[model samples]
Target: MSDTPQIHGRVEPGFEALREVFTTNFTDRGDIGASLAIYVDGRPVMDLWGGQADPGTGRPWTEDTVALVYSATKGVTATLVNRLVEQGTLDLLAPVADYWPDFGKAGKEHVTVTQLLSHQAGLPVPAEPLTRQELIDGTPVLDVLCRQSPLWEPGTAHGYHALTFGWLVGELVRRATGSTLGALVREQIADPLGLSLWIGLPQDRNSSVAPLINGRPDPAALDSITDPEVKQLALQVVAAVSDPDSLLSRTLSTNGALPTPEASTWNDERIWAAEQPAANGITNARALARMYAACVGEVDGVRLLSEDAVSTARAEQVQGPDEVTIGESRFGIGYQLPTHAAPLLGEGSFGHAGAGGALGFGNVTSRVGFGYVQNQLGASLIGEPRTAALIDALGGVLA
Candidate 1:
């Protein structure tokens, strides 16, 4: 068990010290499977993954293996939004209602692209308990959201869009590009660039996708919060999760699978098959890093996001209180900021972390794209063990 895996890659000789850091967290564990890849100044530097793809079957994880990144998919979604802006097809400051007319409901006629991308638009959980079928079905859920009221004045405050964030933003892309975000991503970003990332995971590729495992060993005790009003809302959230029919529960249930309280969401073959871009991006470290590298540099002469687009992508937008998702997340236009909310490659770096420890992001500061994906979900608000350790290792290399 002490013998760490010999996963392939070419890490610089001096940087080989990171192999121990990588092994430390990925140490032999039947329930865990992951992969990590780093590209610095537009070149592949480190790539590794270990543990089992599925403990019951004894399948070993490999370079090509992909895992559901949960929220980490947000950074990628943000990238696509920036790409559209680059082509002048979409405007960041323009009102969202320009593309989707019904989105102007509840005094939200002025909500702009920046507001939605930065999660300041005030739509976290839907006002209605949307069914899981309603969500994976796509059109129905979006219809509810379009006609729903804003939780607050759009630009006055900021909130995180927990589950519906992707669709809220993805729909804008659909209206602007005449293609679903997943379709545009595959045709314009993933396929042309040869990156293994997928927004709408294909059924044929299901075999290589890793399964998620709850590893919080310790979880938050809501009982300690003590405030009557706050406790009430928390309890409601708890009840919604325990109630399998609740929208939050059903939206994540996915093809007969039950939703767990700690895990943000699950990707059954169906969830993956749908184009839920803001979350449910199932790809491995190799794939995530390779795709992000395109944003950081040219890959075979193809750039997914222009240098200006990358700059715009990394620009910080919401930094104080994130009304919708976690209490406070430092967010850029569409990507998670390198602030305390989501720690990553380092300050000035931008990326996203999924529920639990699954994380992925790229660094415009160092011209690097780094990604780490794991099936073992961590309990932390931002991410898990791999995040801190991976960033530390990357910091050493960048230093």
Candidate 2:
């Protein structure tokens, strides 16, 4: 593919420099393909791509090539939860049991939607044996979650929910609206706003998506943790992640009809599909940046959320060593807000870094929404080289 921009959009002062980050590493490090976009104040400024849509066939990455965002889709899902709050159907502060009564069992009656959103409901790293098949069908997995006991006391400490974040939040949406989270997202968030994102994709659109290649694993992360149980859990997460056929793998693989992991398949026909709102958002850089830009700009003639709401989304909701993330991580109600006290994620920015290397976040201070997705997944929790370059260039752009 030519170095010409992959998607059309207005370019901001620092955007071309940001593109260089991808171009340099993308070419030097060797990339199958990548697309990037940047939006500021509701207008797209930069969009570009290089490499192959199908490296296997030497198919060029085109103007519309979209890649699987691994876990970057979580940002989109969190946006829906905010919209639910905006529409008044779901209260972020309400108890989980309020929507699904059975969820109240096992000392979890007090866990609020806000708490769950912040990964403080204490059920991270589920204790029960959950099969990929059961999780593929959300209802069964939820049945187990409802009965499962908390690992830590509710609100006592927070741990990253990893895969369970979607189930916990998605289940609440299902009970509150009587529709799957995917359906509600289509109806309320994407369609209305004209965003190309999807929580669960349909089966027909599979061919357009680029296959995900999880990045090289860091040997240090493997060697550091000595706990047998924690290591086992991490191992399970890693193994499930490598195969597109795993339950969560489906969203990244073929069988694109549903966003659940079990739908993933390694075959060619299974390669592309819709953006799974939780972790399988299939989007181009242009769309990714613009989506967040809308949050900072006028969103379909409406602001994504009022300044107050955005403030709430970005403010520190849970602090201290995260129970799940269990490091310097900080979380806002439904977003990741790193504190000045701990800035591993990003400072004054809000969003999530997808598993592997995909990342999307909005800088409230700069009113910037940036997204970086790559076929080469990185092990860094927040981002890899592509994203780091983008951020550095963005800083220079601002400077």
Candidate 3:
């Protein structure tokens, strides 16, 4: 009923400044609707949300409002796979083709699970265009992916697999667990922890999600990259993204009719209901933060992973210029390592950022888990300044 954005939720005594950062996001940073949550030493220290859930309908953002956290979903998916590794069912160093022989075709025989998880498999996009229906079903897309050739030799270079990461990781999960990534996540992580996150969202829960509003990057968005070689690559990627016939466009816009990279695919119900581990998972800051918290330590008597598993998953597998984004990338298995895009966490923090500003991460050494979700999208390589500010504010408390 109120026209003005109202901040709602609790912040423990030590984390008071986080509340100020959340409020400033609405008042000064143009945040339309967002939530920020943090867990430290196995308990929640902050849980907050404000602004409108749907700007078009003027629906207020609430404690229950969830949103599609594009690539941040990777952190969850990675946890699913890493669990298999911990159980010794899947070996990180083993060839991916060993588990799924079909994946070995077309010069991909030696691609290891580590290479796939670390984004060094050089399969950033599919060899051919696919439809949303294929993405929803996933089997047909997996068939195509198995038979496709790597755009580059495995391990020689690394690039963000983007859309392909879900299929690659999902198929590996199915081979190891006899269950889909979504099903495993629910049974092993979400259900035990009682977290409100979904890899494959149920149709009935659709209305609970906030609608995503797309944003455009300014023409000079890439001007901040100072490295000359990386800058040149960034310009090339930007140009390819704009050209519909380029690999970047064809890969991003599986449906040729839709605009590449900027398509409103996540806004579609079909996307939300499907399991795309690299791109589509519906959740809020609380679920994300709590899930990450469980990864590193006990949260309410539940710990999703052992300390050794967490160490292996967060250990930096690769760091260098990414062939796709033409930006410096750091990856540890399926999680994005601390880099310029998400450098606010401590030295060893690891998590994933969505295409927009959404981010979810946990610092192992610091015993901190943080999650931020926003519907108003921004095209920042690392994360939105608003989310970064919250991370900065968090540091003062942790210090």
**Top of the candidates by lDDT:** 3
Q: Each prediction's TM-score against the native?
A: 0.86, 0.81, 0.92
Q: Model 3, range 1-399, lDDT digits (tens) per residue?
A: 123478999999988999987888777666789999999988999999999999899898999999988888999998888888988989999999888988999989999999999989878776666766776788888888887888899999998887889988988888877898999999988999888899989999999999888775656767787877657766776677778777566656653633323437568888888888888889999999999999989999998889989999988888987777666889997898887655857667988888777889988988888999988887654347778898889988888
- Give each model's clash number: 7, 22, 1
What does candidate 1's lDDT look like per residue over 6-39, in tens digits? 5555576666866667777766332367787887
Clashing pairs in 3: 341-382
- State the C-alpha lDDT per candidate: 0.73, 0.65, 0.83
Give lDDT: candidate 1, residue 136: 80
Q: Candidate 1 local accuracy as lDDT?
A: 0.73
* Cα lDDT tens digits for candidate 2, 133-179: 55555666577778888878888887767667777788888889988
Q: For model 2, what is the alpha-carbon lDDT of residue 206?
A: 61
Backbone clash tally for model 2? 22
List where candidate 2 sits over 4 angstroms from the true fold: 1-14, 217-277, 339-346, 380-383
Model 2 has an lDDT value of: 0.65
Candidate 1 vs. true structure, TM-score: 0.86
Could you tell me the lDDT of residue 43 within candidate 3? 95
